[model samples]
Target: MGFSAEWLSLREPADRAARDGPLAQQAAKAAGPNPLVVDFGCGTGATWRALAPYLPTGARWRFVDNEPALLAEAGRVAGENAELVEADLGEMDALPLAGASLVTASALLDLMPEAWVADLARRLDVPFYATLNYDGRMSWAPAHDDDAAVTAAFNQHQQGDKGMGPALGPNSADRTIALFEAAGFMVLSADSTWLLGPDKAPLQRELTNGIAQAANEAGAREAASWGRHRHAIADRTTCHIGHIDILALPTGNLQESTHVLR
Candidate 1:
């Protein structure tokens, strides 16, 4: 399913906050001076904004996305040092990675199949920084009876084809780590959970609706009622959604390897 610009915009702040800043810094440092960074599924260039400050001032970026509107917004957000490439990531074999110092994607892996990720790992010899992959942990304050049922159903839906074959869903992070490791890369990971409270009611509401919809579609009989009950208490509730941030360093250079934070 295509994500709307509005939804991407709405989630930018939380996405930024939930990423691993130190890992990003390490990735930047490892890229050397004037690194060429290629970002996949880059929506509105949020990844650029999140990592630019920690990178070299002269760092150049290439933002890739299939959606023209998002590419336009990415150009605006990423400014003159950035170039935009409009391409579908589902077409894995055709993905461009030549001369890239680092390859990055945010909240994207979970939507891809295992084979696609393996192919990507084998294709790129550069270090990779991927963030916000769902890790299967979710919690709601003052838990409801149907929370488990709804969550299970939603996760089931997540594994279904999202135009990229069968999605890895919560298994994306582990799959990525294994793929990179098998390719001889050194990988590190950290938690980047979203802790949402009343202040983020809008995001919470949107998430609730999305989960409910996905659950219902996945054949959860209690999904509709669960959605209504969650919405009723959303204003006063807090949520914790788990995610993982991974940095995979290219093998072969010990001197450059020191740049990666353990």
Candidate 2:
């Protein structure tokens, strides 16, 4: 299922804060001047907003997403330098990669199948910057006895098809990096974990509820009570949800290279 604009908006602040600044800057610098950056699953243009300031002046963007409503919302804020393309990302063969100097996506790779990611790596001759991929590490403060079980079920649910076939889930970042490296790209990645404190109570509560629902759907019947406990204490509890940001640049195509590191 496609994410709503409201959800995207709710998560934007954390995504912005958690992103690795130096890695993003490196991708921007590697893009050079007047680059045409194509963003897949753009989701109200958060990725563009996150990277625009670092990119050279005259940089343009193509925001691609399957949802028309989300694309329209992205267009509302993307202004003159951005173009909106409504297309299903599942069709890797028809992606709008022509004339693209850089490619980006946020919270997207973990939902894609391994084959799809490999295909994307083979087709991209430009630098690829992807962010906020889930890494399956989650912890809650004032831990509950059921926390581990609920989280395990949620992670399993994440592997179910989210639009593409079977997803890579927590393994997405490592798999994508390996694929890009095999295709001759130098990849750099950093932990971008969302460390939510009491100030982020709303997000923490919503995320806990989502996890509970996913866990229940994956057959963890006890997660309902676990969710209630977590939700009730959300305002006082802290959360650590692991995520990763990756920047992969094609060798020889870019002047700079960063060695792959965790």
Candidate 3:
């Protein structure tokens, strides 16, 4: 199923907070002036919203997604500087990367398979910055007995086909890094983890329900009960979800940038 605009809206704040600033700056610097940035799987243009401030005003944006409704919503916010394209992300050959100074995606790579990701890496001649790739690590401040089971089941569900063969899921970041490195790109990476507290009850509630649904699908019998418990305590519970951001530049394109993790 495609992500709804409401869900993207709810998580946008957390996504903004969780992004790695230095990595974004590095990407912006590499892009230079008057660049064309192409975003894949662009959900309501959240990636653009997060990165726009750091990028040059002359930068133009191309947001691509399979869902026309989502593209429409993205276009509404991105205005004249943004061009929205409704296209299937499953078809990598059709990606609009021509004349792109930088290519980006947020919360996207984890849903694709290794072969697809590798093909994308090989196709990229410009700098690539991918953010918020799920790392499969999740935790709660007040842990429950069924947390491990629920988490395991949810992760299993994550690897299921997402219209791009078997998804890499949690392995996305590392695998993409290796593929880019092997393709002769210099890669830098950093943790972009979400630290959710009581103040983030809305997002935590949605996350709790979503995880429970995935767990139920994966045959976790306690999913319903776990969901109920988590949802009830959303006001007090703290959640930590791990994500990674990657900035890969073609070798000899930018030799002065150092690899640092923060």
Ranking by lDDT: 3, 2, 1
Better of 1 and 2 by lDDT: 2
- Candidate achieving higher lDDT, 2 or 3: 3
Candidate 2's residue-wise lDDT over 1-262, tens digit each?
5998888888889989999998888889878787999999998999888999998876999999999999888888878888999998999877899999899999999989999999999998899999999999999888889988998999999989986788999889989989999999888898899989888888887899999999999999899999898889888998899999999888866655454565
What local lDDT does model 1 show for residue 184?
82
Better of 1 and 2 by TM-score: 2
RMSD of each: 2.0, 1.3, 1.4
Residue pairs that clash (backbone atoms under 3 angstroms), model 1: none
lDDT values of the candidates?
Answer: 0.87, 0.89, 0.90
lDDT of 3 by residue, 59-122 (tens): 8999999899899888898899889888888888888989899999999888899998899889
Clashing pairs in 2: none
TM-score of model 3 vs. true structure: 0.96
Residue 158 Cα positional deviation in candidate 3, in Å, after optimal superposition: 0.4
Instruction: Count clashing pairs, candidate 2.
Output: 0
Off by over 4 Å in 1: 253-262
| lDDT for 162 (candidate 3) | 83
Error of 1 at 75 (Å): 0.3
